[model samples]
Target: TVAVVLFTSDLRLHDHPPLRAALAAADEVVPLFVRDPGVHAAGFDAPNRAAFLADCLRDLDASLRRRGGRLVVRTGPVVREVDAVAVECGAAEVHMAAGVSGYAQRREERLREALGRRGVVLRVHDAVITAVAAGAVTPAGSDHYAVFTPYFRRWSRERLRGTCPAPRTVRVPDAVRGEPLPSRGELSGLSPGLPTGGETPGRERFARWARSRLAEYEEGHDDLAGDATSRLSPYLHFGALSPVELVQRARSRGGAGAEAFVRQLCWRDFHHQVLAARPEASRRDYRPRHDQWRTEDEAAEDIAAWREGRTGYPVVDAAMRQLLHEGWMHNRARLLAASFLAKTLYVDWRVGARHFLDLLVDGDLVNNQLNWQWAAGTGTDTRPNRVLNPVRQGRRYDPSGAYVRRWVPELKDLDDRTVHEPWRLPEDRRAALGYPAPLIDLADGLTRFQHARGRGVT
Candidate 1:
């Protein structure tokens, strides 16, 4: 009998449980990927992610070919396409990685139901896309944990399974037919600085980061001007690198930095589990915060300014522009920029979340949406009302103002202190600098945010 390996988010060959299971179940395995139109229709198929995905698929196909097998690609509704391939290959079982989003859950159910009609078995593998599968550990009272610290504590104590080995060789049945791999060039409007995809590139990055910076990550991760954080989010988002291996290797090294890095990975899983339990968190407030958020009409121009990186707040604008150019932003930048938009601007969190997804290579429903909620005072933030002061944050994290100057070139001539607030320059100096006046007075913005929350400034 033939076994079909259904590739989903977990695209790499190394440390893939579903692929290993499929290979063990049968002599001939058809590595299949179905491009579901539903994803495109739902707008999850953003251009940058599509480009990154194309690279991953091409890379996975190449890896399979080197082991004497090739990927089988098809397009259409996933259930229909998967069933078609199974029948054509005469496969008796299909194996896929479990996913957390609502769409993923729905697709798994539909695939299983469709295959059941053909008398074929469908197997779903956990911990393929995350270090620990969602729901592996939960608080006693609820289906999911609402906060990160408690979840992280539990996740830390639990033991993880060892990483799986890549198959020595994979054999493809000659009878299978497949489509050509997608070209990333065909994707339009991709960010110019988006990183290359594939397991090889991911492994290389992990190795370099482990040897050079893993130790410093504990103290230096938030040093924005230093650019010290690991640029591994996109790789993990695309499943080009195994989170299981990342945790294992980092733990074996056993340093304070590795522990800190592992904690961030747990945060990733925390969001995943929350999304898994409450898929509506993707578009709705997780806690139903009674926020009288400002309407688009009231904040349209401010939102436009923020999107164009012309907010007149150097740090926030720099982060937004960096995201536009790089398809990624530093973690501290993400928090500060997000807090600026959702808290200072008093805009809806969805607006900022949508824009981030539009440009972020690591854009994911769980992390992006929930993190937005956390910033908006509607999610699990213990101190939900705290606001990030842009100027203070800029001076603190970007002490030299180098990061702001690098991305917001209009202020390039200004020195460190003046760079954080060009509006404070002498009238003639500000005019010559060509930087716009502050879009909204910082005090007024703070007042609006507090008033929106039905509270005065503390």
Candidate 2:
């Protein structure tokens, strides 16, 4: 008997339930990945992620070869390709991890229907992409938790399934056709500092980072200049790293830092659960503020300035520029930058969400969209009217201006106090710096935001 394992977001071999289940149920297993055109059609195959995914595929194939098997790559519509492969391989079962996005839900339904026509059983595994399954725990009278604190409490108490060991040997049927693997070099326009992908590098990074930094994450993750947060998001986003394994590893090294890190992981699952319950929330507001937001056309120049990292707010610009250079940004930076665009600028949150999706290596539909909503006062945020003041945020998180200076070199010569507000410099010095002045006065922007929300200034 033969089984087919369809690799989607959950790419790594360790702790993979679908692959293990398939391997156990069959004499031979086909580790298949379909490069779905639907993903491209949906605008997910952005250049940075495409490059990172290419590296992931190449590395996955190499890993499989070392284990006496090889990954089978296919292209076209996902269901059609998956079915065709199942038929060609004479597979009795097809297994995959459950996904949260609307596209994934539709794709899963289509795959089940398509495969069932040919007598192949489709099995979907949970807790593969997320540490906990999306629908695993819920409050009474609710399909999902709307708040993170209660959700985190319930989520932490739930027992995780133990990790699976990588198979010592994987038997694969010969004569399975596959496309040529993708090359990272062939991908262009990637961020100059994009991290390498694949399970090997991801594991290695975690090993070193966890030992040195996970212990300090609680106290230091927000220190912009320290760069203290684990840069593991891309790996997690790609499923090159296992969330379950990460949770377990962090828990074993228990402390405030690990607890903080685990809370972050719980937040990831929280978003997944919310997204699963309401897939439409990906594009629409989970809790609409009925905000009269500026459209892309109405805010064209401001949008351009924000995207180009020239908004004249040092912290906001630095964060945006970091995303351009590294395809990632610090968590604290993400909040303030998002707040600037969605609240301070009073532009539509979707506008900033779309831009981040276009560039961020870790741009996930579930987390990215919801987080934007939180910042824009349109989601499950309890304090919807609260705004992130970038100037105060920069002073607190990047005190001494090293982070701003690192990304916005135009302020390298400014004193600590003036770096964050270079418009405060003398007229000649400010002009000499060649940096734009504050795009809009903070007080004016705040007043505009509060008024737009139909509230008097708080």
Candidate 3:
């Protein structure tokens, strides 16, 4: 007997349900990854993510090889490639982790139909991509929880699946053929400071963080200057680290910080379930506010300035510059930067979401789109009218101004008190610093947003 394990968002061998099931049910298994052109057509194959994905594939292949097997790589349509491999290997079944996106759901449906025609069964595994599968828990009256607090209350109680060890040995059929694995060197336009990707690096980082930093997470997660949060998001986005193992490990540590980090993991699951229930939220508003957002023509200069980190809002510009240089931004930075664009600039959330997807190494459709909407007052944020003031946010989170100095070097010489509001400096001194003036007066932007949202201007 033979089975094929189709690798999608879930890339690692550890705690991988589909792979383990395949190895158990078949004498030999074909571990497969397909480079689907459909993803490119959907405009998701950005260079940073592409480069990161190359590293993931290479690492997966290397891991499999260490177990006396190799990942079979193919290109073109996903369903077609999987079918061809199944036919070649004469596999009795194909197994894959369940996916949340509309594209992933459609791909799964197509694969089932196509493989069924070939007299092979398709087994879709849940709790593989996510710690808790989408739709596992629901409100008494609804298919999904629209708000997070209620969902988290329920999600916290659900027992996560046990972790699976990497197989001591994996047997692959001799007849299966695969393309040469891709290399990150072949890709361009990647962020210069983008971290290397792979399950090995991810696990090592997690182990170190769990030992040393989990205790400080609650107190320091939003300390932009301290950078105290664990940078495991890119690994999570690629499924290089299992959500299940992370939750388990954090809970074992048993502290306020560990609980806080677990809550964040729950947030990831929360967004996934929301996206699963409402797939159109990817392109359309989950809860529409009839916003007359500024188009590119109206907002071109502001948007360009925001993208180039020249908005003259020191903290916001620092965040944008960090994103450009590192391909990742602190969580607090993301919130303020997103707010500056969606709320202060009164630009469309979609515009900012598109740019983030282009550059973020850890960009996932559900999180990126919904988080942007949440910031823009069009999604599930209970306080839809709330606007984050970048200067105030900077003063609170990046109090020391070290984060700004690191990213926006021109402002390094300024005092911590003056760093966030360089415009407050004397004319000659401000000019000497070479930072641009604030894009729009903070008061003016607030009034514009309030008026647009039908609130009386203060």
Candidate 4:
């Protein structure tokens, strides 16, 4: 008997349930990956992620070859490609990891129907992409938890599935043919500092960081200049690192920092469950505020300044520039930058979310759109009206101003005290620095937000 294992977001060999099940059920397995044109049509195929995905696919193929097998790559409609592979391999069963998005759900349904017509069985595995599968633990009356705190509390007690070991030897039939693997160099407009992607690189990164810095995450995660937080997000996003294994390893190490890190992982699951239950929330507001948001026509200049890192708010500019160069941003910087765009600038959160998805290598619809909504006062944030003052946030998070100096080089000569507020410098010195003035007064921005939200300015 033969089986077909379809690789989706869960790309790695380690702790992969779908692959293990396929191997156990059949003597020969076809490891298939279909480059679905539907995804490209949706406009989700940004260059940074495309480049990273190329690296991942190459790594996966290499790993399979090392195990005496090879990945079968196909292109076109997903269902048609999958069906063709199954027929060619004479597969009795097809296995895949469960997905959260509406598109994923629809794809799964179509595959099931298509395969079922051929008398082939489809097996969907849970806990492959996330530690806890969506809808596993839910409120009595709800399909998913709307509040993260409550969800985290429940998620903490649920027993996660045991991790799966990678097959020591994979057997593939030589009859199956595959296209040549893609190269990252074939992709253009990729961020210069985007990290290399692959299961090996991700595991190595986690091992190094978990040993050295996981202990200090509690104290230094928010310290912008320190850059102490583990940069494992891109790996997690691509499923090169399994969430189940990450949680298990972090807990065994056992410290306040490890505990905090686990909590952060739970947030990832939280967002997944939310997206699963409310798929429309990806493009629509989760909790509508009836907001009359500013369009590009009305806020074109301010939006352009924000995107180019010339907002004249030193810390905000630094964060924006970091995103442009590295295709990633610090978590704290993400919050402040998002808040500035959504609340301070009074622009639509969708606009900011679109730009982020355009460049963020780890950009995900569930996390990115919902986070933007949370910052814009339309999501699950308990304090929806809160605003982050970029100046104050810079002083608190990037105290020595090193982060700003590194990214916004024009402001490199300023002292820590004045680096975050260059407009306060004497007229001659400020002009000499060549930094633009603050685009809009902080007080005025706050007042505008308050008035739009129907609250009197304090």
Steric collisions counted per model: 0, 0, 0, 0
Query: Which scores higher on lDDT, 2 or 3?
Result: 3
Candidate 4 or 1, higher lDDT: 4
Cα misplacement distance, residue 264 of candidate 1 (Å): 0.4
RMSD of 2: 1.4
TM-score of each: 0.98, 0.99, 0.99, 0.98
Instruction: Tell me how many residue pairs clash in candidate 2.
Output: 0
In the range 344-407, model 3's lDDT, one tens digit per residue, is 9999999999999999999889999999988988888999899998888999998999999999
TM-score, model 3 to reference = 0.99
For candidate 4, list the clashing residue pairs, or say none.
none
Q: Residue 24 in candidate 1 has what lDDT? A: 88
Total clashes, candidate 3? 0
* Residue 9 lDDT in candidate 2: 96
Worst 10 residues of 3 by lDDT: 449-458
lDDT for residue 226 in candidate 3, whole number 0-100:
90
Model 3 CA RMSD to the hidden true structure, in angstroms: 1.5
At residue 102, candidate 1 shows an lDDT of 95
Instruction: Compute the lDDT of residue 25 as modeled in candidate 3.
Output: 96
C-alpha lDDT values of all predictions: 0.90, 0.92, 0.93, 0.92
How well is each residue in 1-458 modelled by candidate 1, as lDDT tens digits?
Answer: 79999988888999999989998899999999999888888788888888888988998888988999888899989999889999898999999999999999999999999999999999999998999999999999899899899999999998897798888799888887788888798999998999988888888999998999999999898988888888999889989899999999999999999999999999999999999999999999887657777767888999999988898899999999999999999999999888988888888899999999998988998899999999888888988888899999999999899999999888998998999988889999999877778788878888877776765222
Comparison by TM-score, 1 against 4, better one: 4
